[model samples]
Target: MTETTRTEASKLMTEVEGISGAVLPEPAPAEAVTPLEQASPQEAEGIRQRMAELDMTDTTSIVQFGARAQSDLQSISQEMLSGVKNKDVGPAGDSLRQIVTTIRGFSVSELDVRRNRSWWEKLLGRAAPFANFVARFEEVQGQIDKVTDTLLSHEHKLLKDIKSLDLLYDKTLNFYNELGLYIAAGEEKLREIDATQIPAMEQAVADAPEADKVLHAQALRDLRAARDDLERRVHDLKLTRQVTMQSLPSIRLVQENDKSLVTKINSTLVNTVPLWETQLAQAVTIQRSREAAGAVREANDLTNELLKANAKNLREANAEIRTEMERGVFDIEAVKSANADLIATIEDSLRIADEGKRKRADAEKDLVELEGKLRHTLAAANSSKQAGGAV
Candidate 1:
């Protein structure tokens, strides 16, 4: 039978048991059981050929491998279940591996399918419950494998994110710190202008010869406007600080979470999975007697329960990763966009202030020319008045 067919049959058997409240049939005879012997040369060669045909990187290979194992088991099960009711032990024994000496003493009649259960057999029960646990645990194990592979695939990218974000935050933080110093220095300059320069200019406007009053007033206006532009730049710097403060926390939070996740993954790989493997070894130990089988079943059941509980950590880790990814904390575009806008505004403000200074210089030159022309006209008028008086 195919692996899929076997799996379906297993499920159907379970459903039947549920309806009829009848226990599953006894496990196939030792001859029917496929022991964990080293693969024969032919079987190993076949496995190698099949694996060589597959892409190792493709996750579907995992399923294919499980199916291959199941198919082998199904073939063995068919051989044991076929015509066993009427056949003698001799024929059945002939079909088994040479290691069939273990049960050679038992007669065909003694090995009947409907034999009465011994006291120990009744007490130990079958391995169905343990099998169920193993089946469910296998599913969980597959999930962990996929999750671990995914986490590893993105490991480098996540590290890159942490580095980029850290560098960006540090650079911006330094800039803001320097800006704080600049704002302080600018405030001091403004205070000096208020204390000394502005008052002196105001007095100059007040005490200026009447002809120069308009020129003095214009100079003072230009100085005050330049100071106001400095204040505006300081205000914009404060806003930039606010933006950096607000955005930085989220980036830091992501970085911390990522670090924590790395630690958890390492722990799971180094400690958790290895421990599970050790427990699995104990659970799958080969045994023949009813008591030994019972012990193995209990061990497998406990291991499965422990694994089911531990699987939650993997689920939680994946969920946390998705949350941070959805938040886009590692994406620098938004932060870069905001910084670019602020830089452009600062550049524009500086440009406008420079234009204002050029206008002020031109106004000063025009005032100087007007004053020279006024002096020349007054000299010419005074000479005309003296000449007229002499006449």
Candidate 2:
């Protein structure tokens, strides 16, 4: 009887495995797969052989994350060797190297995926519900694995976005800063024209009113157009500052939510899966008890063993599900504060640049005035000397 039961169980297990084999997703094709180790000469030879037998584009691989013992230098060296072994090209090699590089910096994959949840969502539990599944058993570990891949991919994109946005902001700020200085310099020169130069020019203009009107009108028009340009640039800077400010809440919320989700997923996964070793042990013990029973079995009692095993599983599953459902919310204050700081920086940077421009424009107006006065003084001196000689 015992031999019969064991054989039955083995057969059942085999059948289950067969069912699983059908549903398993095929490993992704390795277009740009690089690993985090230098394959030894022997391993390299093995890869070479493997490559020869197969399509290079069809290789599939698993990238391990959360191993902290390896240094960046070590990871890079490993990737270099792996690249040679696989003979990766173009996107495949680049993609594989990037995954290895990013995983090296973080604690785990949850820490890496930032796109789905904002920083605030993590703190406040707004999106906390989505991560519960990620916390479940190793049986569902593949779901968690998928999420991690998504996270790593997201981290790369966010990095590129941050760098690009920062570059634009920096360039725009620099342009405005330089333009402001020119405006200020022009304004200061305009201011410095001596009081008497105005009257002297008027007297000179009396001798040729039409010429003076044409020249002065054209010069005034040029100055006015320049003033309009400076005002437009300043106005554009202000609008950009406002747009960037409005984005702060969303950008910061994303970062906060991502961190929150990683923590929750880690807690759920650890709580639900490791307990399985205990569950399986209990299941085995219950089966043994049923096996040892003698002639005392009745029809109702015969079904009792199966019922007991199912009950234990139901209880454990229910308990874990309950705990996860009741998990507490996170605090969003940190995320809010960060948003405020970024907004403040945007405002402050714009103000500093604008202030410098205003001062420079004032200085230019003064300088222009001084230039006109100096020209007038030299003209008056020359005219008087000629008049004295005539007398």
lDDT of each: 0.52, 0.43
Instruction: Residues 61-176, candidate 1: write the lDDT tens digits.
Output: 32232233234434533543462334232332232222123123224333233346577766888444345445544654555454444433333334444455455555544444
- Give the 10-residue window scoring lowest on summed lDDT in candidate 1: 27-36
lDDT of 2 by residue, 243-336 (tens): 4344444444433443333333232233422343355345445434543443246545768977998999999999999987886564468768
Off by over 4 Å in 1: 1-135, 154-158, 161-166, 207-219, 235-258, 277-391
Could you tell me the lDDT of residue 137 within candidate 1?
49
- TM-scores, each model vs. reference: 0.33, 0.26
Error of 1 at 342 (Å): 99
Model 2 alpha-carbon drift over 4 Å, by segment:
1-208, 244-253, 268-391
Task: Kindly give the number of clashing pairs for every candidate.
Answer: 0, 51
lDDT (C-alpha) at residue 295 in model 2: 28
Clashing pairs in 1: none
Q: How many angstroms is residue 56 displaced in model 1 relative to the true structure, after the best TM-score fit?
A: 69
